[model samples]
Target: MPEVYHLIVNPAAGHGKAPEFVQNHVVPLLHHLGIAFELHETKGVRDAGRIGAEILTTTSFPVKVVIAGGDGTAHEMIEGVLKAERDKKDQALGRWELVILPLGTANALFSSLFPQPPEPPSEPSSLVSYLSDTGPDVLYQLSSLLASLKSTTPARRLPITLTSLESPISPPTEPIQSHIVLSTALHAAILSDSEALRSSYPGLERFKIAADQNLGVFFKADVRLIPPHSGKIKQYDPSVGNWVDPFTFGEDTLSGPFAYFLSTTTTPRLEPSFVISPLLATLPPNPSDPPTMDIIVLRPLRDPAVRSALASRGDEAASETWKSRIRQVMGWAYKGGGHVDLTYPAHRGETEVKGGGEVVVETFRCGGFEWVPTDAEHEPSHIVCADGSLHTIERNGKATVQVMDPGHDNSDDGFWVWA
Candidate 1:
């Protein structure tokens, strides 16, 4: 246990349910466990991060931060701590741990860390029994946190991605650190659009609506995959059921009218059911190992069937076909990230085509990647999302994303999570 638990609560998260949940459930549980804590509520955006930095800087080593909110709140807090570590160099910033309470719309980090069972209980049980026996299905994360608090096991180290904008047209900007995801193309557009719909939808439905609005749109960009510490950029070859060096010929740049391009560090699912990167969970990374990002790329033109369809059918018909295909891939993503294994057949017809040839989706595990928009006039292609927050790469600019080394040397003290 730490000197004290700094409970940072975001009242606006989960459509204003976080505060109530913290009071009714979390507070009582902490009291029951006889843990000393200080409560702080966030008034607006970035408040959580500010409070987290304050706690980390002022408190002693091995402090505990209980975040009673969603991924955005957690992201802000982590950013605060990381920023403090950068700025407050002379002062000793003690090591700390994060405990998450999934009170947000899309608890991506929480869901990835403590995934729910595939099947529910066969028999119904009382609320008390459920809490005592298996834990609340929805509130099970809290139970996991509490159990960890009582155990002697060390917290798990969390690897984060550092995303920087490199612009020749403008001066250098600050690098953004993300614990969950950093994306462009469709994912960035969806996150960018979904914020506008938050007031109206205020739930996961906003993402769906945003996806509908941006589904047919294709983002043009030049992507380059940087090799890991091993000096090899490995890609998942579905045929071999393993990762292989696809760029052995020294080709790393990928030209694309990309449909979807997203990368994840700690999370596999942005939503509970959305398993965008299933390998993150099934084949987890070791904390002591060099950090690498799991990237999911969808380039519709790479599929020969779609290409033949495009040449036979006009742009409008090909657009519809690709949109339908994207939708199908998304459906597969929800069903245990099945989209990754989809392959294209060698042949095609004028009518609708189903899978069976070269792998349609390109999945890679790399240390970093760079995204450069091909057209300066196309603004959507420049949009970049770092942990749900949106950014734009300037004209003739690009974004470079790399995993930060965690506590590899004496100069750095990295982050960890109470898993």
Candidate 2:
């Protein structure tokens, strides 16, 4: 049980409804429960992290931090907690727990654990995407957190997937420890474009518009899935709901003039109900297993229908047709991640269109991966995204990632969330 409750709230969240709701709904409820608490509202960029680190370092033992914000706010708080200066000798002196209140565009990390379908919001929030849900469901979630804290149920340590971006001009920057997702290709492109539409559209429609803009661009790269030494690379078997290694089919490397490539730590969807990586949510990894990321990759050239259709068409026509197919795949993603279960065969020697013969989506479970984009040939492909933050991998530089689960490996002190 918590001795004190420290809430880091973002007033900007839920279209500025966070403060009003937390104050009226959350505060009174906790007070009624006799929980002692303090509220801290974020002022500017990275302010949440600053506050979180300070609390992690100085807060009383057995403290519970209730983050009344979205994933980005929670992300910053976690980053602060991880980067804070704490004596290694005092690691056992205190206990900390994190609780994200779901107040952003996408509450992918928190939703992965709760998996409760959020109720619709009565008013607009900061962004009108997955995090817009701020109805009575929020009360239920808070109550559940209360139950967990009051009971003996232990919080689960969330595994982080770290990506290191290296450029020849400088040493590798601090690894982006992502609890939800690390993405590039179509995923990053969409985020890059959609962010610009934030003020204009301010809702999920921006993502659709951005997707329309980025669907045609191909990402040129050579990729490799790096397993932990002596471990095997694995892929999801949708038919059986199990994981299997595709190494038997061929070697583990992939070269791409790619359409889509994304990896998830635990999130099954970038937004609620999109279900981009369905199995991640449905079949969470066993505690005894090594930490791994769920990756979804798409290479246009692999589709026979697209290949044959493009062969007869002019270069421009071929590109347009290819984009159409890709849009189809992305469209299927929203249909409960149905894209992964699909088989697109070669119709008229063309694999770009759905021929219904072979599976189009390539889903894998890996320890990490290397994304090396071709120089200038596909500059857009070099862009990478962790959560919502964008990073660009310069020419000749590559971004690599590894899974880190403190609960399983404990090589380093890490983080956990209120389950």
Candidate 3:
């Protein structure tokens, strides 16, 4: 049997059921598997990262760390592992692996790992059994997968790109920090405003309220779409059921008083039912490219119903249209709506892209991006969310984000979830 370290556990995940389930089921199963272990708890935001870093620095054995919470906790663990090895040589940092337990409102990361079944809630013991009894082989396979994921170059400090939000009156200064998650535009604003309504709208409804509050407001900004490390900007061709490189005539520039824009690092599906990024799991990141983010967007002006005369009616129409679009988007998400033909409507109800469509949403994969909002107004451009931590954009500024793996080497460590 090998020694393992379980990272921070948030007792409140899944409405406080995770800790009990782990104690009753996971512990005994780990014992049965003959794996030695230890457990740590998070005291506050970002604590998990610190704890994980500590383990990598102080511990001197081959250990596996199991994170018993949701994606945010796991994210911190990953960051901690990367941060711990910053001072060490590159050859030693690429050792640990990550494993997770899904115990949050939206266990997106777990859903990405294990596809959802069209059934009801099973007890935690069943899930525990599957992960502990049936998962070791997967871990062995991951060991091989990781070997291939290692960078061909020397180990270096994995630079994390942070997007800073600054107020317009004041000049922007510090950058917002994150390890796993990052967001801005609509998603960031929704999370920021929705925080106050969390108790009333305990789950996803907060997002709805935030959406409603910010709905008709057009965001004026310039977007620079960077391609992935090893691939081009891929756009889904409905006819092909696969991604093809976006056929742009010139520069891949996007302009807006746009509706939605957001990205994710690991998990594509945000919740159990919300299957937002379906292709993420089937194509995990490779060493040559590394695992990056899939950005999803919804631009309302691309709809054919849009017109200059309707410019005055834009706000009112946009609110209704946005509501309808959101519902449709959710439905499409449920049905794996890769085929939803979102055509711009022409005058007299014609569906065509003669001039262009208004509802054209763009999806892209990239190593990083830049979001520069217009600065002419008193209101902030939008909020930015990094793994649930929110930051408001400063007036007259932009937020930039880039993705890179944290460097971990001989310093001392690797992640191990219970198996």
Candidate 4:
């Protein structure tokens, strides 16, 4: 019955590239579909949310909001819809569907959900064709994405995962903020640092720069892994490409001084090459739940050569050591480093860690987690990035993230983008 659709456009997305695409292509396509739409171009950061909230609540039209920007714009639209639904019960629709148009750089969610072909010229039609061609199989692959949404029954509480940062003014507040992608140590730092460089670089290069800057740093913290709805954590057995509950590790499976610790609720592969949670999208335990978080962790102790700390020497020696560390870390990321088989060559000039050593990264799949930063010392654990937005965790406090599944008996139902 909701034939009407609301178009939320971010004119400044992709550093001012989205508007042209929307004007040239998207609008014409909407006309061809014969769909009723009201376009709302975003003004500021939260403008999409504000505009979406307005259209959803004030208008009596049966509508779906199509987000016409990248991931950041999509995220803002979602937050806006949820907030409006939460505040205005009568206007809040039973199911608010989101149709994304990937118009930003690092459109992580869109890219992960629908991988661009290896070749170039990935256009809107190609994406639509992929969706229609794959049929339900795509849904089957993204079971976690769908099921997670249903399980949350977002129409109910609309769960929010908050990461609170400690500041001199405030202690800790209730219900901090929720994030869909990259929540934790390095992820937060990358986003936090990347903001300043966004203007100068304005593209993926900014992310690369941030990664280079933060690659050598590690955060000190203790992690508490909260399992899926079943109250149990799942591990990917690469051999089978499925999630298997690891019964041994419990709440405190992770201790920090970690290099990279990030989690994703939806959209498994951030970039095509960066298969952070290959198993989440490809082989999840349940296909019905797509909202579950795929957590990727990098622990330094897992490094083979890190048996002992290297003493700092002259400027040249320190620079060389730093270079080695960077290359090693970056290599692991490139080779699908499951964090299990990372070995830093110990003796002489060898590459393998002494004795074929420890697992450098410990990856996990779960509903939520709590990151408690080290306060005794001035550690790097003072940051948390939620959906490309930065937030820091309180020194003595923790950040708890749990996946919510908003489900219904309507097996015939789900959200999809119209071609």
After aligning candidate 1 to the native by TM-score, how far in Å is the CA of 417 from where it should be?
1.4
lDDT of 3 by residue, 178-284 (tens): 54457666666777778889888878878778877876555667677766555666665444445667642247767765667777655657666565665554444
Task: Score residue 276 of candidate 1 by CA lDDT.
Answer: 95
Give Cα distance to truth, residue 372, candidate 2, Å.
Answer: 0.6
Instruction: Provide the global lDDT of candidate 2 against the true structure.
Output: 0.73
Task: State TM-scores per candidate.
Answer: 0.89, 0.85, 0.75, 0.74
Per-residue lDDT of 60-124 in model 2, one digit per residue for the tens?
65567888878888778777666663334344323556776776656777666666645532222
Lowest summed lDDT window (length 10), candidate 4: 149-158
lDDT of 1 by residue, 207-293 (tens): 889999888777989899987765577787766767788732248888888889999988999878899998777666665667889
What C-alpha lDDT, on a 0 to 100 scale, does residue 8 get in candidate 4? 80
Best by lDDT: 1
Score candidate 3 by TM-score against the native.
Answer: 0.75
TM-score for candidate 1, residues paired by index: 0.89
Q: Per-candidate RMSD vs. true structure?
A: 3.9, 5.9, 6.6, 6.9
Assess the local accuracy of residue 238 in candidate 1 as a C-alpha lDDT between 0 and 100. 68
How well does model 4 score by local distance difference test?
0.59
- Given candidate 3, what's the lDDT at residue 108? 60
Candidate 1 — which residues are off by over 4 angstroms? 118-139, 196-206, 247-250, 349-356
Q: What pairs collide in candidate 1?
A: 344-357, 345-357
